[model samples]
Target chain A: MSSPSGVLATGSAGDTRPAPVVSIRGVSKRFATTGDDVVALTDVDLAVAPGEFVCLIGPSGCGKSTLLNLVGGLLPPTAGRVEIGGRPVTGPPSEVGMMFQKPVLLEWRTVRENVLLPVEARNGRKGAKAARGRADELLGRVGLGEFEERYPNELSGGMQQRAAICRMLIGDPDVLLLDEPFGALDELTRERLNLELAKIVSGTDKAALLVTHNIIEGVFLSDRVVVMSARPGRIVDVVDVPLPRPRCLEVVTTPEFTALVARVRELLELGHDDDGKDGDR
Target chain B: MTAPADQRHEVPAPAAPPPDTRVAWGERPSIWVRIPTWISLSGFILVLFALWYLLSSLELVSPFILPDPMDVVAELGNMANAIGTGGLLAEALGITVLESILAFAAAVVLGLGFGFLVAESDFGRIVLMPLLVAVNAAPKIVFAPIFIAALGFGISSKVALGAFIAFFPLLVDTAAGLASVDRDKATLFRSLRISRRKTFFKLQLPSALPFIFAGLKTASVLAVIGVVVGEFIGGGGGLGQQTKIAGDLLATDRVYAYGIVLAVFGYLFYAVVAYAERKIVFWQTPHGVQAGG
Candidate 1:
């Protein structure tokens, strides 16, 4: 079975792996379409330790998002198991939060209502009063305190994505699985959101596993970046960022950040180099 | 492909800000675009009235066959005395309005309930969709006589016919709306591990609102038709019966009066639905008309 890349998986002296918030045990996914089965991920084993921030970086069709979906329990692993906080995830786990490529806010709902959707879904109308307060706190943190009553269409793409980030946080889940949440935003908005996400994730003890194609993005926000190979994806490398905590945008320009970003780029190339060979054969 | 003549290079976040943000809430439409539509509608109505007056005054058709527009207008005043709460025409109006509203209510409830059922499960959708389509294909009004026979020639028959006519579109739109939930949105619900009932109310029902309202609009208008048809064939009392009676007696002016009343009534019914739509669907920027609420 393919596991998290060897370097990061290995521990230094007295390495007793702290209980991970998320745990995947040889998880693989296969989509049975009209004809041949499409293997999305193969024997993929990984874990997110409590309060850790991990990023999965891969080329298109590398099954990184597929893996995220599996961990979120939206899709069952055909061959292996996914567990969150020591429980096998037969279905979506209440302990997890999810953010998607699009904001996925209910269009008819106001921003506050959209944020409170999961709360309402879990607790019924009784959950309303307390959840409203939590929604307000999260929205304010994301700079959307004043836009609570506005509908999604009224907000900009950046603003809508920010609200979505808040929605994911409102559940106060221990783990966050974000599938390229800022993929559609512009560069400037993306940078701003990346900072906001970093701050939000760090302030809470929630472990985060995000999938991104952007090299700099994966390196900047992640404590450790997992690089996976394409088509039947397997993690080939993991690079730990040595940059100091409370990373600012200016950190992107420094030597240590540049070295980590360069290392990730090199690892990605090596992963794809194997893909090119397999394709030729 | 070559770039368009007036355009710049490729973009996602275009250099210019989005129009959604740029345009202010109360910005007025250009005068040329706004005034022309109102002018054209008013002019068309005026021209139509003038043509009607000329054709009647010039004696193109016999006065007995076609009354003057002036006479039709005057008849509205005279018809008021003939139409009290107890009068035949007034009773007919009451019957029609009551039957349609009742049918509209019934269709909305039945359609929404059934639609949620069909949409929630694959088995329900597969079993019920074709049956609905088959029933919807045939002319709904053809059952007016059957309804009149089974339910009797009372307001019950008219309501049955109205509900029958309205059932198809309401069922279809409601099911579609509920089924149209985006996959990503559904994932959010799943990830939260929320109860199925809450998902239906908070996600599926709200998601289906626009489509359900569309069906309501169509059904509301069709309800009127259903009731009128019931009156026409089933020997009931409504504007349809009044229209038929006037035709037989050669009360051509009185026929004109009933026609105008029906037209005005139809518009008022439609306007009420539109107003409700405006209130409920306030989130959407209003454009092109739907059938009813």
Candidate 2:
């Protein structure tokens, strides 16, 4: 029943609300282990509206990644359903592009070729060749124009991830599923990429659901930050960021941004305490 | 951590310099380092050669035991003439080269086939893995007599022995390589809805090439050894048989001549594989040094 603030479910007066690009309803995932079945996520319901950015943030083991996977259609829900572009997701949906913490660029491939992977995967070699101009444009947008012919191993970590982002966009997917895509970068590089990412997503109709543990990053980028609790991962809070759009690195110093960060940290600690108390039973 | 606004932009820009994109053929030592290295190498060899010539010419050792360097050179000239004219030593050398090449080819085909099978399927792994381990644990040269007994004194026996010896390293390395595909890459492939065939060819196979080549390099050396050992046991035509005959006849110089030819062949075979590895797995740095950002 929880929806991001300002994103109204029912149109008041005569306003028409757009349908979400990604919809997950009562989705639960349990992983079978030797001792017992591990509940990764339980009764997870989420909707990412087109042109909105949502971040899932929690301490480790909260299964933020599991929720992303559900939307990505990489993992099937044990209960309920997930829909992308109004279609029930039974496999990796062509409408979604997923990225992990690691760039996952093919070392043998040139950066341009790596960016064209998804298109090639979907539409074959001819499709990839047709998309080369777009791939180079994406790379150039991320300051990697000169490095397109270089291999993944030849690029720096941030540059490689930039190439990976171009790869995700080359498929022209409706939704982006990012699982800690910038979690591996240094603080400065992470901030710069965050700015680039915001610019990349702002004018587009694509919805982004990013999973991150960093509180500042979530607040800086997302319209709403979905906080989950540990282990039997449940949505504990959905902190709305009312910060001004096109935020820069200076926004972190503002009282509102700092307040939002402190609130999320408090909720995370509360979740940790709750987990500790539950273990005593 | 909050940095001053101006410093924030500065750090991101300078944090990563453009990575060295050139193939790490190797870190080419500076001319300063190269000159000294060459000097030391040639100096050591010259000293050894001078000692060898002095020890022989002064009769410090009997001629039967150690021939003069000049005599060895003369013997080399004779062997070269024999090779040019298609003499016995030349035929033996040709047979040895043919056996090594054939064994290496057979080992590569079967090793790659079985390596992939074991790596890709549970049934193949469960049944063949233990058998491979057991066979690999044994000294492969010892099996030459068994191959000779079954296949007789022929080129086939030598090739069989060579392939049997060389096959293990390639198979083990290949399986390890296939299994070592990055977990994230697998997930990325799955997320992209890439076909299983494309995933194998595009992602897994290229990643496994380095390991497969490493195994091949080891197999190359083993292939030659296997063929020679088989020839030694079976008295088939090869440098191994020629050397044995020369030793029995007290033709010490001829034995030395055959030894030199065999050593050259082995080195060349190994060099050829190493060169191929460098070409095929072009991304990998020589000596496994990861080229840095």
Candidate 3:
């Protein structure tokens, strides 16, 4: 778990906060490949309190995505437990919304229809029909209301991804699990989205865990950046970002943000020197 | 010190995701590409008719063996009453159309049902699939006689034969389509905790529709073939049977006229399927030079 200091960010005098919205204890992930048991993640622990934005970063093939999957309840840990809102996660929970790297929008559905897909999938079309206003509101927030009726194929990659973001928020999930949500975008679009996501995160008390390769993005959006090591991945360090919110793209220019990025990079390199992969994950 | 120097340069973004392999799966091939091909096909057909016209006008060949194109057209015009009512050709066409429609509907329902069943169950694939493939591979024309012997020269025999013959393509194609769901999309559904039933209906089924419609386009033509052949073998007076009788009577113009009507009918069937496919998968359908989304 991260230090209680991080959780204290959400606390004030005379106000009680419950357990962290997301908790992982001794969690590990392994896949039985054809020839060998490939350990993707091993014995990693972490927690994210309500309203916090945590970013997980590491080298290629690190279990950053695996850990996100574990928290989303898409993958069961081979060893420990993943709990959300104090309950052990056995399968996908209603409160957890996930956004994959690709938009993964249904080609047949319109933007508005796609946004309400989870609601429709959980309840029937009538349930989704009732949430139409909410779906359009999300689309409007993402600057996609004009294109709500357009098919996914008709939209550009960036626009489709914006629709995907709207879909994730339409569910209004308590915990948002993002696997490189803006990783596929161009630099400017990614920076703009980081600022937008940070603003959205601040607006809602929903906790978000984002996995990304971009360290600048981590500094911009994260309250705490979880640095992980590769192979049978483990958390090498957690860097606290006391950066104030509604952080803008200008934060990347600050010495404090630059120092935090450098520090996380240093920890990642040091873990490589200390044989992170060679150790039991 | 180096970290400060490195930080002096802007932190680079990771490279953009590769453009999706458009060929992997997307809209139809463009109209710009299709138009010239259609013009060529029409030109080819026109050239063949012109050669036939030249041959007949020159008396270079026996008219009995190959009727003149003009004579066939004239014969078709003369048979307008027969084509409309009390005509053997009109009766034959009505029979063929009915049988094809029934066969097409049956094939789609059964083919999709069996295709999904086999794709979903390991046990079904292990046992039932091989048998289906064997039946599919067999010369389906051979079964026409058995159908006739069992159903005894009625339309039922033709319907049964048509249904069986058209069934295989839908079955095979539906199975192929269902199995073609993108891995990431499937994982997304699991993460959303969608019910298996919902997954099948909304995701697998819709995703499969494009491929399935492509199959349906093929099965539409096949269903026509099945019905005509069944009518030929089972002794009902469909276009197939009428054409055979016209051949026996050496009514070459009448035969060509029936052939013309049947060709138009087949084109209509194919066009209907193609049109339905366009509406259902409009996102992927090609327009001019490219299809997006």
Top of the candidates by lDDT = 2
Give the alpha carbon lDDT tens digit for every residue of B1-293 in model 3.
11221111222235566665764678656766667878978988999999999998898988777888888999888667787676776777788899889989888888888988888899767898999999889999998888999988777888888889888888888899999999878988998888888898889989899889988988888888888888777778788898888888998987888888888899999999999899887777742221122
Instruction: Report the C-alpha displacement of residue B3, candidate 2, in angstroms.
Output: 13
A1-281: candidate 1 lDDT, tens digit per residue:
23333333322223345667677777778889899887778877677788888999988777898888888887888988787887888888888888988999887888999998878777766796678988998888777777788787777788888889988888788999989999998886777778778877886678999999899999889878988887667787778776777877778888888899889899899888635222200
Docking class of 3: incorrect
Cα error of candidate 3 at position B76, Å: 1.6
TM for every model, in the order presented, reads: 0.86, 0.88, 0.86
Report the lDDT tens digits of candidate 2 across residue range B190-262.
9888889999999999989999999999989999988888888888888889888888898888778778888
Top TM-score model: 2
Q: How many angstroms is residue B222 displaced in model 3 relative to the true structure, after the best TM-score fit?
A: 0.6
lDDT of each: 0.79, 0.83, 0.80
Native-contact fraction for each model?
0.39, 0.44, 0.33
Q: Could you report the DockQ of all the candidates, in the order they appear?
A: 0.28, 0.39, 0.21
Instruction: Candidate 3: give the clashing pairs.
Output: A153-B293, B27-B284
The parts of candidate 3 lying over 4 Å away from their true place are A1-18, A272-281, B1-47, B59-65, B286-293
In model 1, the clashing pairs are: B217-B292
